[model samples]
Target chain A: MTAFDPARFTRLDQYGHGGRLGIRYHAKAEDWVELALPYAADQVGDPSTGVLASGPIVTLMDMATSMAVWTRRGVFAPHATLDLRVDYCRPATPGETVIGRGECYRLARAVAFVRGIAYHRDPADPIAHVAGTFMLMDAPAKQARA
Target chain B: MTPPPYAALLGIAIEAEGDGPPVLLLPFGEPVLGRPGFVHGGAIAGLLEMAAIAALDQALQAEGGGRIKPITVTVDYMRGGRERPTRGVGTVTRLGTRIANVEAVAWQDDRARPIAAARLNYLIERP
Candidate 1:
């Protein structure tokens, strides 16, 4: 097992769904990771309002939480999402990049508790909030690489 | 009604039948993949939300027309989605003047066995 590296992670794969959506690593710490999703025409839920869909924001948070689990463990291990709850506070401003910050608050043997928020320049005024859990694989060999 | 651009990005289409809610179809491809062989959780969630909105839109249209705005959603994953086309549909349980509650489910191959389910709340702006 090795420490999770966001820079290397992006350079390795460029064809996954996340990559196609332009989700990139913004910042990270010991127990949390922040990812960025740039607003694009393809992500618009409403052509009238030009607001990004709730789905893309969900994707951003999922990836951020997945990476946060690895960062908490200090290794890139395999895991699966068990459940997730997302609350949309408001519509994201069109053309503004949405930043999602995921934090692994608790890590047990088989599960990791995670929470996150999506915002623009200020996290205090978040556009969305999420809480979820990931089920850890028993052995590293059983990892799914998500 | 035509789906938005985000629906196309997820490879989703509305399958309307006789007097029933529309079913959303998500085909397996590079745009929906996670890891290598499995579908991404977020993609599945996206599909569910789309289905929910479609169902709620139908309900609201009957009463006159209104704007649908998402409030919250909770998704529960039961199984890993394989490399296959997934189907999702939403059922609006309650439609009030200001709020609506919808339930959505995503399944592959068999409807009885769902890969994931979601509960969503929306705020409606009446016209």
Candidate 2:
């Protein structure tokens, strides 16, 4: 397996679901990755309150955890989400960019355990917390070039 | 409850279901794609959450209107969402003055074979 390249990773698939949600690379380390979801009117859950929807935040964490998996493994491989659980502690401050940071706590041969928090202004007072796992699909056979 | 931003992003539409809470229909599109051909898990989660909210809203309207605040949600992905219309309906397991528990399932083709299921807990603020 080759080392994970942040530059290439961000550029390769820039128009997937995560990208469409306005999720962008924020920062990353050896075993963790952070992504940001900018507040948008169309993403608001409640217009009166101008609060962002849970889906965007969940997507942010999903992408963050996925990137973290690649970061920890030092490579990118196809994986599927098994399950995800989220706890909304506080409503994310409206009009603020939500930052999602995910860490790969345990990486088994077939599964990876991840936990993350979403926040806008204060990390301590996060908007939501998430815990999930991804199933690593076995390496696939070589694909034919189009 | 109104459709959230994510719903619009995914083009999820509300279809009337026999005068009850509307059913959520997620049209297959680029924004909902995952992997190569399947619907993204996040998109499905978004639909489930919306369905839950819609159901809760209807329930609240019945027992006196109230504000809904999401507290927690657990989503289980059972199968990949194919390139077809996906529908989801939420059921309120218990509606109380303070807390409400809801469950939702999204499926395509056969309603029995759900692509995903979600359980949500919301904090209600009675008017």
Candidate 3:
């Protein structure tokens, strides 16, 4: 069975919210995936400071975490976010691309546990921290689907 | 209060009235869809956060305005958001001198039954 390919999955994102938000794949590991959100004027949460909105950051983490589950399982399947929590350490610097990395730590029969962080330049200095769980819709299978 | 650009991106509109928290609306569209038949979880979270911010802003405006900075937010999704317009409203539970706690709920057809809910904490810098 072939492992889930985040690059291929993102390439088919023509009509999804992630595509509209300009999210792109950056890197991937066995249990984690990193995505990038370029700074845009339209995504400004505060017009005065040009700070990117928490919403878009949440979106970036959500997609990254979602993909992390697939990467961990070595297959793509249907799932839904059950709950998510985000803590903002600071605001993103204006005009810098926000990189989000999500890691799937535990995969159960019915749910997947994930945590993520969003940072501008260094992963050590994250702007936001995220923890969430996704409800797995399909049962585990031996063969991976491409 | 002027709606920010992110509001426009999510198709969020404020339905404000006489000196109270505004109701935020998110219409179903391609920009909000996640898995074809359902609205994205992030979009729903965004709506709830906007609602919480609106409520806090209204409360702060009544007491001589302040800058609101989000500290943390936790959202729980109870149901899958279908292809329809969703509504969200936030209520301030406690507004302290430095910190504020707010809760928001989002629903599609029935306000009594929420599809998602969120709890948010904010740091307020008084003006």
Tens-place lDDT per residue, model 3, A10-96, is 463466688788888988876678999999899888888999888889889999999899888889899988899999999899999
Fnat for each predicted structure, in order: 0.87, 0.74, 0.80
How far does residue A137 in candidate 2 sit from its true spot (Å)?
1.1
Fraction of native contacts, model 2: 0.74
Candidate 3 chain B minimal-lDDT segment of 10 residues? B14-23
Per-residue C-alpha lDDT of model 2 across residues A39-143, encoded as one tens digit per residue: 888888887798888888777888888888888888878888888999999998887999999998998877888999998877798889999988777633353
- lDDT accuracy of residue A67 in candidate 2: 83
List, residue by residue over B1-127, the lDDT tens digit for candidate 3.
8888988999999765566688899999999888879999889998998899889988998899999889999999999999999999999999999999999999999999999999999999998
Give the local distance difference test score of model 2.
Answer: 0.84
lDDT of each: 0.88, 0.84, 0.89
TM-score of 1: 0.94
Worst 10 residues of 3 chain A by lDDT: A137-146
iRMSD, model 2, in Å: 1.2
Put down candidate 2 lDDT per residue, B40-111, tens digits, no spaces: 898889899999999999889989898888999899988889988999999999998899999999999999
**Fnat for candidate 3 (0 to 1):** 0.80
TM-score of decoy 3: 0.95
List ranges where model 3 is wrong by over 4 Å.
Answer: A140-146
